[model samples]
Target: MPPPNALQLLQSIFGYEQFRGRQADIVSHVANGGDALVLMPTGGGKSLCYQIPALMRDGCAVVVSPLIALMQDQVEGLHQLGIDAAFLNSTQTLDETRDVERRFMSGSLKLLYVAPERLLTPRFMGLMESGPVSLFAIDEAHCVSQWGHDFRPEYIGLSVLHERFPTVPRIALTATADALTRAEIVKRLALENAAEFVSSFDRPNIRYRIVEKDNARKQLLDFIEREHDGDVGIVYCLSRKRVEDTAQFLCDNGITALPYHAGLSSDVRARNQTRFLREDGIVMVATIAFGMGIDKPDVRFVAHIDLPKSLEGYYQETGRAGRDGLPSNAWLAYGLNDVMQLKEMIENGQAPEAQKQVERQKLSAMLGLAETVACRRQTILAYFGETSAPCGNCDNCLSPPKTWDATEAARKALSCVFRTGQRFGAGHIIDVLLGKRTDKVEMHLHDQVSTFGIGKDMPEAAWRSVLRQLLAGGYLQTEPEFGGLQLTDLARPLLRGELSVQLRGLPEKKRERAERGQKRSAASLDIAPADDALWQALRSKRRALADAQAVPAYLIFSDATLKAMLDAKPATLAEMAHISGVGAQKLERYGLEFLDVLHAS
Candidate 1:
């Protein structure tokens, strides 16, 4: 037969029926000696774009990955497909490195994954000079941009690839990047001439929800108990201390939770990550330090006890869940504290004024997202410059938020901030607005002010909501020095009687939203009870097989595939081959075993 083409290799080795979205075009471009910059979402099969091209091209593809764990995972996955793959990282012994180096130089390996740090080493560059490189695949290419959430200085040195291997095709790929970050990646990586492939940023399988923070831990527990029990998920915290405490609390509540952060020993973090990937139903409680380039595909949900720093970070983190295309959740509990803390970080950090301004803008966008009552999906997509209609599955669309004419309330709050010399934060401003004769108010002698008691009619929460909306709506701004509120120029129009503000009211009662969430979560996550036993049996078999092979279970077959097996009731090898993930190699390896299980069922 003619040398196997990209499509032939894709079906024979990877087992997917067809390319998704721009995969084919991307694979063809790179295989034909063209450079590319691919911006696809997580779980969008970015690996196939390069892997297929590598097999179709002349030599081993040098995949510059960031994480050692990710490199090992990808190598193992390719090995499972019976493809020649290996990774060279710190985790490898000198002998192991030598072996992979030998394989690469001999052209026996189709793909070689190396960390960016390692790839930049003179030693590794010398190795690359010794052989023909089919292409250079830079995964998480957004990390090259300082503006990206996960910036790495090592990624900046990657431009050397273009300088040295000028003739070799190059592909830079990232799951998350806004317009600014995209341009930065192109400039930084010297990919000005690469073909650009931007896929849809939407992840419709995820049900997005943002709730106001109130007893956030209790609310998180309720969500866990109701919807995500016995399922793998991630609970993101804003601080290392919170990660530790939350993981302990979950464990105390009889949930399997692990803490991951930069503070932990590398050994502990690695063990936890290995367990999370290899086992099912592990809830990883971590700060922003975790969940980059993770390959697990069955994570049922991603919950945030604290607000994420940016929309890009939020999207990338939550994209970790429901990678198998099953219904999953992107849930968050945000409040004014999250806003204040994030703003304080941005302002107080040592970054230059322009970078800080960009960060503040990003955070402001995130706050608007938190406070938005419209479709959460629409807001996120719009931030990415993609327009989308309301997705009825989100919290806002499912249970619409209440709104009130807060124009007068907003004016009162703004007047309070101004009359207080704009030096007071929301709490004192609320106290002043509510006419509370506290020591601070009395000390400041603010009871004599014109706007002091003008807003006593509204409840304290409602007043806080109004102030929050004022801040979120740009009618008010925060002074980072004292965490106080000030009026922005946008407030000028409102103060001048040229504008009116209408704010979203509180969501439905906690009990009501929780009840509705319970129904929705059940419908989203649960399989048919009649097939539950078979599903469990198949999972157990997968787990057993994974343990024997010492690989993650999902690499054997995702939960979605097992669930499909339960539903399809495939009875023979040929029938098993018809499943979505069962490529020829996989079917030849595990098809008979799964068919036997189905027959037993």
Candidate 2:
């Protein structure tokens, strides 16, 4: 039943025993010059949606990717499968780019990777005219939608590919896209006629957990100390400052940590990034700036110290974990401030009110996912408009969450917010709950309120839970400038006793969870540790180097590089220079220090 050339190329290059899922059908449709819109999850082999078609077609397929590193990885992956491929980016040298262009001019190149901006160039347009573009693969095609999580101004230029080359088969691919984004991708790419394929969004291998925000630093430490110790992963923070501080604190506490962000020079970003990719047992702390195009396969876990911009953003960032098909953890902690911060940002941005409102709704849904008692996998999948039964793999399914009766506690917590005119934070509210009469509470005469001492039966911990649930439920909204709470229309109903508020089930102590032990093992170190202590010494050296440079530690060689060095035990700077990320500049600058550390250890 397989069509001409489709069956041949699939086995020749992919070597798969059989096409997984609807891959064969999609490939067959596109091989016949049909357009495609694919929604496969990470590691679902989405690349084949366009790859097989490129192999069977007449001219080179142009793959538009957002990240330079990702383009390299995809091109490398294609070449590993014995397919001829090349990428054009800032990383490629003049001669290298010229040579790749040489292949394209000869009609010998099967695939070419290009950034959206580069593809829209007059020079690139002329190149397209010279050689036929049999297929166009738009990777992360959601970026073209202004409403999508990772919008790029460059992607708006992609509309031209179809406008100019009306006959070339185009396949737009993304790991995550909601219904709105899906529609936008179609309109933006002019793929209205494109065949649609949406794979299940369920990441069955990941367990999702959201803890209440109090003692967040301690709680995070406690969780990682027990379950994810010495694992190479990513910790996401809300701000550049937090990213830097958390990375430093983790280093001080005996964990190998590095900071990454856009503020740092690109050289440092690339150096740290290379370490993360090529090294093992290294943890990188970053803001939203870090996840796109990251290709590390065994990221054991992803922890967020603050909320993301949207559920789509959160899912894509967390998807970076468990890409190697192993069990991994996705943990986060947030409270009322995260809500106010997100809301305030939207309210203050320049976009149309409709876009801001849409963003707000998306963020609220994400908060619901964090607080919901339903299966995390089901909740996340539903957000993407895909329905699934309980996965029995996430924290929710394994725990089968149980709720508590907090009716009296809810009223008291609301009472404090109501009496104080919603003008204080959690600490002040906690004081009134236990009748502590703290300086701020007494200063405001909140100690005399009848709500005071009424909440004594409930532990301060329980009051904290009640307040978070109420905020997430929309019963309360934080006033950013006033730095306090204000009752929403939702709260008036609850306050007048017109509505009864029900709280979701709470998480157990981190250790009580079934996945309490580490999901990562040493074999994940693709480069076996010739010397275990070498990584530790390399980290120590990185800290000193970062301090001396007044840059984030990751600006030095990353945990990935140190691991790669340890694995290969390269004895010279020349060999280290051959690594993917290190260039002549870094090899000359930091190479000796790392080599000395490796040798000394």
**Whole-model Cα lDDT of every candidate shown, in order:** 0.88, 0.77
Candidate 2: where is the Cα deviation over 4 Å?
Answer: 1-4, 510-601
Cα lDDT tens digits for candidate 1, 343-426: 778877899999998898888888889999899999999999898889887878878888888877887888888998988888
Tell me the lDDT of model 2 at 371. 83
Q: Per-residue alpha-carbon lDDT of model 2 for 1-601, expressed as tens digits?
A: 3444765555444434467778888898888999999988775668778888888887788888888866765665555445688999887889998998888878788899999888898988898888867799998888899899889988988999888999888899898888898999999899998889988787777778776787666767776777777777899998999888888888888888889998888888878876776455689999888887665666888999898888999999899887755667888988756776776777667899899889878888988998888888889998988889988766667666677766666777888888878877766887888889778878889889887777787777777778777877787777756557677887766667765766865566664544464333411344336565676677788778656744435435544555667777767877766553354445666778877886786
Indicate the worst ten consecutive residues by lDDT in candidate 1: 517-526
Model 1 quality (TM-score): 0.97
Per-candidate TM equals 0.97, 0.83
Best by TM-score: 1
